[model samples]
Target: MDGGLMLAESLPRTSSFATDRQRGGAAFVERWTNARAGVIGFLTGRGYSSCSIAERIDDRPETVRRMWTLWDLSAYGHDGRAPQVVVPLSQRDRAHLAGAAATAGLTIEAYCEQILVNSIRR
Candidate 1:
């Protein structure tokens, strides 16, 4: 583990498997780190479960779920949280989200649902 997070330096950097990242900036590094975390988690001991996918990708169960859809993993459904705080996004962000979900082979909703369920058992 690198700095309390898993490393996925070996994952593909090619055009086909590339994720949505900034040209070069702090945000780029942050997103790159998150992607690596998710990849490492999945390749190591997490698989599609919460700690690996969710923990690695978004650092939050809800956010990870959202990532699943962004990468196209499939939706895992909602966690039924109260107050339903809404996070706003622009058109480009939504496209990026969809790309991420597609890459993960999950949908935003189902991916999150799956993470919550797996986390419960861990």
Candidate 2:
């Protein structure tokens, strides 16, 4: 999931919808889908309540809640291959990260994942 988000973020964001329409919709759909998933994953992983997340994303709270319920159930199907890992940070560091994430229009978790992946690649 982290890798997917990293790859998606690496892509350019300049072309307009007109260009996308001319080229066909696959790229547009794929990019939009990845971005949507990244936002949802980031919000949920960062311990935001569904209502809060929905408000932030301009979505309905019930829709966000339902998505979360489905996500939780799907995690159990991972067969222990994707155990959750906690990374502790100082309050100041967390505040900094939250600000950065908000500026980038991403959840803190997604922002952190992107940072980690970039660091690793370097």
**Which candidate gets the maximum lDDT versus the true structure?**
2
Give the distance in Å from residue 75's predicted Cα in candidate 1 to where it truly belongs.
9.7
TM-score of each: 0.27, 0.36
Give lDDT per model, in order: 0.48, 0.59
On residues 13-118, what C-alpha lDDT tens digit does candidate 2 reach at each position? 3322222232354554323344555676765654555665566655677876677676683554322223233477789989999999999999997898898889
- Top candidate on TM-score is 2
Model 2 TM-score (2 dp): 0.36
Candidate 2 minimal-lDDT segment of 10 residues = 14-23
On residues 24-89, what C-alpha lDDT tens digit does candidate 1 reach at each position?
665543354554545633543323444444443445555655655566543333332221223346
Model 1 clashes, total count? 30
